[model samples]
Target: MKIIQNFTDYHEKTPLALSIGMFDGVHLGHQSIIRKLNAISEKKNLESAVLTFWPHPRTIFNPNDDLKLLNTLDEKTYLLQKNGIRHLFLKEFDEAFRNLNGEEFVRQILVKKLNVKHLIVGYDHTFGKNKSGDFSLLRKMSDECGFKVEQVEAVDFHEKHISSTQIRNALAVGNVKEANEMLGYIYSVSGKVIDGKKIGRTIGYPTANISSDPLKLLPKKGAYIVEVFVKNRKYKGMLSIGTNPTVNGNSLSTEVYILDFNEDIYGEEISVNFRDFLHEEIKFENIEKLIERLDEDKKLTDNFIF
Candidate 1:
């Protein structure tokens, strides 16, 4: 997918079938809208495009609040690419951009600038100043702007709508299975391997330390069954997300011990896909107790299915 960021000259002549949102996690609900865009693009021979915003509106509007996102900017792009969209337009959500009202946004950005021929949105889609834009507003504007509009109904799981916020809540509590159900895929964290205290190495289990984007939301401090990606190859692993209290450590860390794997990977990029919550981080009475728990975690990681 071609990624057009803010300040990038966007001069595509071909009309676009577009869906617009921040799409933080690109969860199931967002995927439904993209699927509609794909179908419409194929039918009308329009370019499948998504207009997403960065700096998250929340970060712009509520700078004081701590903001943790399900996917980093790059991770969101990678997931969206898997949907087969042709274009990914990233608009910067800044003070200047926030002032445009619904009508102005439609006229200046959508109708004139992007030449959006067909618009696809979610059931609860809203945009523009004060978020006054809705399905009703889009329907009204489509007629005036000489374009088509469609809204995909809420995609639900177990009677609850699948949403990025819901997925975040699940991850916040280390409910990765529930989060993955809503996301339609495994939740992952991509980071560069970094040198650490090497505490795990002294034990039988050696771990690779990960340095991730600070804004990236991590699962609750605990152990997890994970699939690790290294050098284009995959391995099963057990990940720990917490301070090593057993060793009197103070700082939190994301460390993973890959099964049957032992090669220096520090400074290399890797991704860990969370599968399930294995257990909570415990400050065991001694290092030996921690080792026992690590052995148990390895067994669980090895036998994990689906």
Candidate 2:
């Protein structure tokens, strides 16, 4: 997909069938809107595009609020591309850009710059300063600007609204199975393998430590049965998420010990998909006690495969 970082870089002459949103998790609701965009683009013979923002708007508007993200920029891009979006336009949500009125945003960015032929938006989508813009205003502006508008109804699952907040809450409480059900896939974390104290090796369960992205949200501290992917190969593993209380480490860490395998993987980028939560992290009395618990955890994790 062609990624336009700003409106200044949008030089395409062909009008685009566009959908605009934060699209944080790219969850099922976001997929519904993107699918509408794809269907419209195919019907109109126009390029499918998504206009999103960085700093998430909320982060800029409410700096004191804790903003945990479901996917990083690279992960969101990959998900958009997988959903048949051909163009991605990302705008930095800065103070200056935040002041644009609803109509001005439509005129300058959507209508003039992007030449959006059709806009697919969610039912509750709002924009402009103080979020004063709503679907009604967008439709009015689309009519005035001579463009088409498509409003997708909010998507629901199991009679409840499926949302990023709900998914995050599930993960925060260590409900990996519920989170995966809402996310349409296993909840995964990606990061670079980093150097760590080699204490796991001495205990017989060698581990690969990952320095997780600061922007990505982590699940509740616990041990989980997960599938580890490295260099295009998958391995069954048991992952611990905590501050390694057994070793008296004070810093929280995500460490994965690949079962039945051992090799140098430092500096390699890998992903761990959490399939099920095994148990909460506990502090062991000693190295021998920790080893015994690790052995039990491994046995419990062995019954599940991802």
Most accurate candidate by TM-score: 1
Model 2 misplaced stretches (Cα beyond 4 Å): none
Regions of candidate 1 where Cα sits further than 4 Å from its true position: none
- Give the deviation of candidate 2 from the true structure as CA RMSD: 1.4
- Prediction 2 TM-score vs. true: 0.96
Spell out the clash pairs found in candidate 2. none
| TM-score per model over all chains | 0.97, 0.96
lDDT, candidate 1, 156-217, per-residue tens: 88898888888888898999999998988889998999999987888988899999999999
By summed lDDT, the worst window of 10 consecutive residues in model 1 runs over: 5-14
Q: lDDT tens digits, residues 144-168, model 2?
A: 8978998998778778778898899
62 Cα displacement, candidate 1 (Å):
0.6
Range of the 10 consecutive residues with the lowest summed lDDT in candidate 2: 5-14
